[model samples]
Target: MKNNKIFLIGLLAMVFLTACNEDVLEYKPEGLLSQADVSTTENLEGLVIAAYAGIANDEMVGPITHQWVYGSVRADDAYKGGGGIGDVDVINRYEMYNLTIPDYGDWMTPKTWVNHYKAISRANFALELINEASEADFPKKTLRQAELRFLRAHSHFMLKLLFKKVPYIVETMTAEEKANATNDMTNDELWNMIADDFLFAYNNLPQSQDEVGRADRSAAAAYLAKLRLYQAYEQNDTHQVTSINPARLQEVIDYADDVTGALEPDFGNNFLDGFDNGSESIWAAQFSINDGTLVSRVSFVTGLNSPNSTELYGCCGFHLASQNMVNAFKTDTNGLPLLDTFNDVDIFDSVDGNGKAPLAPGITLDPRIDHTVGIPGRPFKYRNTVNEAGDMIYNFSWARDPGVYGYFGNMKEQQAPDCSCYVKEGPFVGTSKNVDFIRYADVLLWKAEALIQLNQVSQGIAIINRIRDRAANSTNRPINAGATDVYAIGTYPLTLSKEDALKALKFERRLEFAMEGARFFDLVRWGQAAQVLNGYVAVEKTKRDFLANAQFTAGRDEYYPIPQREIDVTGGLYTQNPGY
Candidate 1:
C-alpha cells in the first residue's frame, strides 16, 4: 500500500511540472503578436498606418470623419432625413437645439469622442515607440514622429470643436497619469497644446508626402491657420466672442501664406472620385476596396445618407439639403448671391409647386449649386441622359421621409451607382472616395476671413472675388449649358466696406462649402450660433414645421456635452461642458 501511494504522488508531481514548464507558458499563438515583436522598425511603420486608419473609423450610427449629423443636420444645411424622427432620435435633438444631456446621442456623441481619442491613442503609442527609436537605426523616426503628431493634433482639434474641453493624452503620460487626466483647462491652453503639436509637424514635415493620404507640411500649416483663426475669436464661458485677437488673425494670414496647393480647374472635380488627392486636396482620409482584406476599407460614414430607390443605390435618405439651403444659392440681378433676402422666397412655391415637376422660371442660381445639390429631375451626377433601366434622374421618390424632410438629395458625398467607388453592404451604400480633410479653397477662405477681421478689407474682398470668379466660371460645363439662364454668379466689389465684405465672406463660405458639413461649426466659431440658428429656425420652421419651437441657447448649444460615461468612469474627474 505504501509503494502504490508513493507511485501516485510521483505521477502527480510529473504532470504538474510538465504543465508549469516555461516553454508551454510562454507559447504565443501562431497568428498573434507578442510585445517585443512590435519593437522593430517595420512594425513601427505599421503602428503609424494604424493611426492613419483610425482617422476615418466611422460608421452609419457613429460618424467620426463626416460631420453631416453634427454639423449639417444640426445647422440649416440639412435635416435628419431618415425613416422617421424616431430613427436615431438623438440626431433630432441635435437638429432641434434641445438642451442635451450627457447620454443624449451617446451612440453618436460618445462614439465620436471615443473614435477621435482612439486615433489619438494610436498616434500617442506610435509616438512613444518612435521617440525611443534612434534615427540611425530607423531613418524615418523623426518623420514618422511628425506624422503621428499631426494626426494627434488633428483629432484633438476636432474634439475641441465638438466637446470644447478634453484631456490631452500624450505619449509621455504614465498609466497613472492617464488615469487622472482632467478636462479642466482654459480654452487658450488647450488650443496651445494642439497648436504645439501642429507647430512641430509644420517645422519638421516635408511640403509633400510620398503617400497620397499622408499629412505634409503644407497640410500642417493650413490646419495651423484654421486653428489660429478659431483661436483669434476669443470666446468667454458663455460662448460669446468677447474679443477678436489681432495677433492671432495675423498668425492665420502667415500660416495660410506658408501653405501650398492649387484649386482644381473645375470645382466639380473636387467631389468626383477620380480627382481625389488632386491639386485641391491638401490632405484626405483614404478609403479602399478589393485590397486583400475580408471586407474592404470603404466609407460607411455616409452609409445611411443614400437614396431610397430600390433600383438605384438604395438605403435611408439622410442629409438632404434644406429648401433654405437650396434658396441660399439664388443670385440677384447682378448675379451675386442675395445676401439678406434669400429665405423670404421659398423656391418650391416659386417653382413647380413642390420642386418635383419641371421648373417654371424666375430663379437664377449660383452654378456651384449644381455641384452641391441633387435636385429632382436634374442631371444626377452630371448624367444628362437616363440609362436603359430609366434611372439616372434623381426622382422625388428618393426621399426616405418626404413629409418630414425636404426633397433634395445630398450630392457631394455620393457616387454614381455604376462608379467603382460605390460599395453596398446590406441596405447601406458606402463609397471609397477619399474625404478631403483639408482643401485649398478652405485655406483661401480662412486667409480671407482673417484678413477681413484684421480690417485689411480690400485684400479680403479680392480673395472673395477670386472664389466668386470660380463659381461664375463653373458654368463652363456642357452638362449645365442648356440651363445657363439658371446659373449665374458675380464677383464682389473691392471698394465695399469691412461690414459688407465680412457678410460677403460669410455668404461665400456657405455657397462654396454647403453640404461639406462645416456650417454649424462656422456659426459656433463666429459666436453666432444662437442668433443665426435661432433666426434660421424662425424662418425655416414656417417651411418645415418639424422645427415648431426650436431654439439655440448660446452657451449650451455651442458644443455638445461631454459623455456621461466618460465622467463616471473617471470618477467625475472629467467635468461636463457648461450648461450641460
Candidate 2:
C-alpha cells in the first residue's frame, strides 16, 4: 500500500513539471511581441493621438504641402512667379493639363501617399489589436475601433480621389500578399468600402468628442454624404448613371439637420479667432496654440516670406487669388449670382494708395470676396504686417512681375513677426492655426451640395444663405440694416426653378469653398470639371500672356496616371488609367 501511494505522488510531480515547461516556452519578450501587445486599450490610445500628431509633419498635414497641393494646385488659383517658384510652377503646369511619368522625385505625390498610408497602417494595426482584446475592454474597443476606422476611411478616400486605383488594403498583409495584390476593384467598390466604414463610424461614434478634432457622428455622416454624391455622378465604363439612392440621400439630409442647431450664429466665426469650438465646425483639425506643437504648413506657405525667410515667397507670394475667382462673387440685380452677366464685368479694378479700394473691394461689394481675398484696406488673414519692410523686400521678386507669375500670399492666418523668419525650428515660429483637415463649414457645404443634387434645392439654398449672412452681418441670419451695408449683404432668395437652383448651388459652393481643397473634386463629381476647367484655361490664356502656356484638354487630363514606379513594382499586375 505504501509503494502504490508513492508511485501516485511521483506521477503527479511529473505532470506539474511538464506544464511549467510549456508556460516558459510561451513567454515572449516585450519588444519581440506582435502589434497586438503594443495596441492595448492603454497603449493604443497613444497611437490614436499619434495619428493626429502625424498631420503636423511636413509631408502630411503640415501647412506648406497641404495648401500648395490642395489650394493653389487648381485652375482658379495661380502660383506667384519668382526665382523660387519651382514647386508652384509644377503644380500649375499639372493643373493646366500637363501630365508626366511618375519619377517619385516629386515630393508632393509620393510624400502625400506615404503620409496617408502611414496613417492608414497605424489605424489598421490598432483595429487588428483591438479586435483581439477581451470583452471587458469593449467600450474602449468600440470607440478606438470607430476612430481608427474613420481615419482609415478618410485616408483611403483621399487616395481614391488622387490615385483612383489604389490597392485597398484593409489589414497589414504579408509581403507576399502585398506583392500579389492588385487594384482590380471598380470605383463603385472603392466607394462602397468608404461608405461602409463611414456608416459604421456614424452609428457608433459619439455626437461630439471629449477632445476637439476627433471624429464624431456628424463628420462621419457628412463624409458618407459626400461619397454618395460622388457616386451619383455618371460613369464612363459602365455607361450607367450612378443614380442617387433616395434613401441614402435622405439619410444625409437627416444627419445634416441633426447638427443645424449646433452651428454658430455667425458664419465668419467658423474661420476667425476663438472659433475653434463654434457650432459651424462639424469637425476641424485640432490644434492648440498653447500646446506649442501646432505646426501648420499652410501658414508657412501663405504667410509673409520676408528678409529672414528662405521659403518660396520671401515676402507674401504664392496662391495669388485670381481676378476671375473674385469676380465669381458679384451679385446680380436681385442680389443673386451674375450667371448671365458673369463675363460682362471687369474684374481687374484699379487699387488705391493704401492697396485698398477699387482693386481692394470691401466686403460690402461681395461678402465672399471679403472672406476669401485680402483687399488693400482689410487686414490679411495670414500675413506678417509687423515686418512690412522685410516682407516687401523678400517678396519683391514676385511683386515686380505679378503678371509673369501669380505672386500674392494668402492672408488667412499669419504668423507673428518674431517667428516669421525661417529657421531650423521651422519656416514660421507661431502656432499653425490654419486647418489641415476637415472644417465645419466644409461639412455644411457638403450637406448643401448633396441636398441640391437630391432636388432639395430650397433646403440647400437655406444652408448657403446661412453662410452668406454670417459673412454679411457677422451673424448666420439676415438682420435689420444698421452698421452693415445692405447692398453688400446680398439676399440668397430662391426664385429659380429646380434646375436653375442646382446651378446656383454649384456657383455658391465655388465661391464659398474656394481654395479650401474641394474645388477640383467638386467639379469632377458634378460632371462639369472637364468643360469648366478647360474653358477657363483657354479663355485665360487668350486674355493674359502669363496664361498662354496654360491649357487643359478633357478626357486624357481628367485623371492622373498611376505612378509608373508603382506599376513597375507590380510587374504589370497593376493596370494604368485608361489614357495614362
Candidate 3:
C-alpha cells in the first residue's frame, strides 16, 4: 500500500511480459504463464477471471473493496484513527480536507486511481479477445462479455465517484484514442457511458449464476438503479445539484422494481461470516481465507482497522466511528432519532432528551449502534462468549489513540479473533467475509432517496422505516454493558412532510450504513457534504486537536482532485479537476 509496495500490484499485462535480462539466464520463467497460454478460445474465461481478480484485490492504502478513507473518513461517519494523525498521514490529509492537491505527493488517492484503471484495463483486455470470437466459437460469449463490461463499468463508476471527470475507456479505443482520452466529457455524458455498460449487462445477464461471485441480472438491475439515482441529482460544474430529474428518479424506481433481492431476516445476518452471499447481498466482492493461496484472499481494505489489542485483533485501529455518528442513533421520547440536536453532546457524555439532564437509563438509542460501533466496556461484535484471546468485552485499551480519535471502532466489517474467517497478518486482522457493493438495503434506500426527491414523500418514508424496523429487531446482542443506552428504536410516521421525510431518509442511511463506507458519497450526492462535514469538524476539533485546522472547501473538495500522475502518464492530456 506504500510507495515501496507498489510493485506488488503490477498491472495484469506485467504477468505476460517476458522478463529477459540479457546478462542473467532467463527462459520465460518456468512457473509463469504466457498470453498465448491463457488466451485460447477454450481458455478465454481465464481473461474474464483475471478481470474479476483485478477488482477483488484489496490493499489498505489503495481503493480497496471498501472505500473507508474516501467514504467514511471524508464524511462525518468516521475519523481516520491510528497511532496519530501522522500514521498513514495521506488519510489524515483527506480527513483534514486541505493540502490534498493532485501533486501533493500522497500515494493513496493516486494509487487508488491506478488500481481502478488496472481493473478497467483487465476488462478491456478481455473484451478485446471476446470481440473477435463468435458465439459459435465461444458458447458463453455474450454472457461473459456482459459480465466483463459490468466489471468495467463498476470500476469507472467508482472512479467517477472519487474523481468526477475520469476518462471513459473501452476496448474499441485505439492506442492513440486510449492515450488521448481526457477528462473533458460532461457529467451527463460520462454517467451515461458508464450506465450504457450496465444497461447492456442488465439486458444480457441471467438472473442467477452457477458461481455465487459472478454478476447476475439482479445485480445489474441494482447497479442501474444506483446509477440512475446518482444521475438524477444533476450537478453543475461546481458539483452542486442543479435539479433532481424526475425521469431519472422514475428510472431508479423502475430499475429497482426489477431487482429481485431481499433484506436478511435479521439485520445482524448481513454482517455475519456465515452469511457471505445471503439474500441481502445483491452483489459483493467475494473473499476467502485458508484457500491454499500464499496469504489467502482475505479483505485488506480494513486490515488496519482491527483493535490494537495484542491478545485479540493485534495492530492498528483506523476507521473509528465519529461522535456525531454515535449520537445520531440516540432517540427521544417517541423513540425517533434526535435529528437536529443529536450532535450537541458527545457520545461519552450524552445529556437527556432536553439537553439539561445527565445520561441515564432513559437515553434510548437504536440497537444498530451495538452492531456498528465497538465501545469500551461493551460487547464486541455481539459476542459475550470469550474469544480465543479470552476477552469478550471491548477493552478500553484496544483503542490505539483514543485521545486523537474517540473510543469507538468500526464493527460491521470486522470478525472475532477466534473465528475461522479471521486472519492476522502480523499486526493487522483480515476476514474472508464478502464486502457488499450493493446490498438489498441499498437498493431499497436508493429508491427511497429518489422517491423523496421526486416528491413521493410518504412512499419514501415507508421504504426507510423498513430498515428501521429491521434495526429495532436486531437487539439480539450481548446485553449492552456500557453506561450508554440501548433501549429502543422506532419507525417514522407516514404523516411527515417531504422535507422532513428527506431528512429522515438521509438520517436512516447514515445510521444503517454507518461504518460501511457510504456516508460521504451520500452527502456528496445530496449536495450536503460541505454543510454537514464542516459542522462535524467544527465540533470534532474541540474534542480531537488534529481537526483544529480542518475545513471542507465547497467547490474543490466535493470531488478529489484528478491524480497528477495520471495526467503525466497521459502526456498532460488529462485536465486536473477544478480548483486543483
TM-score of each: 0.92, 0.79, 0.92
| Top candidate by lDDT | 3
Clash count, predicted structure 2: 26
How do the residues 205-296 of candidate 2 rate in per-residue lDDT, one tens digit apiece? 98877665677887787777667767767456422234555665666666665553255565445555455545666645544433222332
Tell me the spans in candidate 3 whose CA falls farther than 4 Å from its real position.
1-37, 350-359, 482-484
Count of backbone collisions in candidate 1: 0
Q: Per-residue lDDT of 1-580 in model 1, one digit per residue for the tens?
A: 1111110112211221222111211211121345466657767677777777768777877677878988899998988888877887888888888756778545678878777787687687678778888888899988889998999999999899998989998888877788788999999999999999999999999998766678889999999999999999999987789999999999999999998888788888998878877888887787776554556668889888888887888788888888889889888888888999988777643225444434447778788877887777676677767774356666777878888887788888888888877788888988778788788999999999999988899999998888888777775553342443476678888889999999999989998999888999999999888898888898888878788977888789999998898888789999888887
Q: Give candidate 2's TM-score.
A: 0.79
By lDDT, the better pick of 1 and 3 is: 3
Error of 2 at 21 (Å): 36
Candidates ranked, most accurate by lDDT first: 3, 1, 2
lDDT of 3 by residue, 1-580 (tens): 1112111222333354224322110112122655566556645776676677778766887865797889998898889999999899888989988755675858888778777777787788788878888888788999989999999999999999999999888988877777677889899999999999999999999997867778889999999999989998999998988898999999999999998888887888888888877788998887776654567667878889888888777889899988778889888888899999988766655323332223355678788888888876677887776745576777667888977786787788788877888887788778888888989999999999888888888899999989988887777657476554556777899889998999998999988899888998999999999999888888878888888999999988989888787777667887887778
- Clashes (backbone N, CA, C under 3 Å), per candidate, total 0, 26, 0
Question: What is the C-alpha local distance difference test score of each model?
Answer: 0.80, 0.55, 0.81
- Candidate 2 local accuracy as lDDT? 0.55
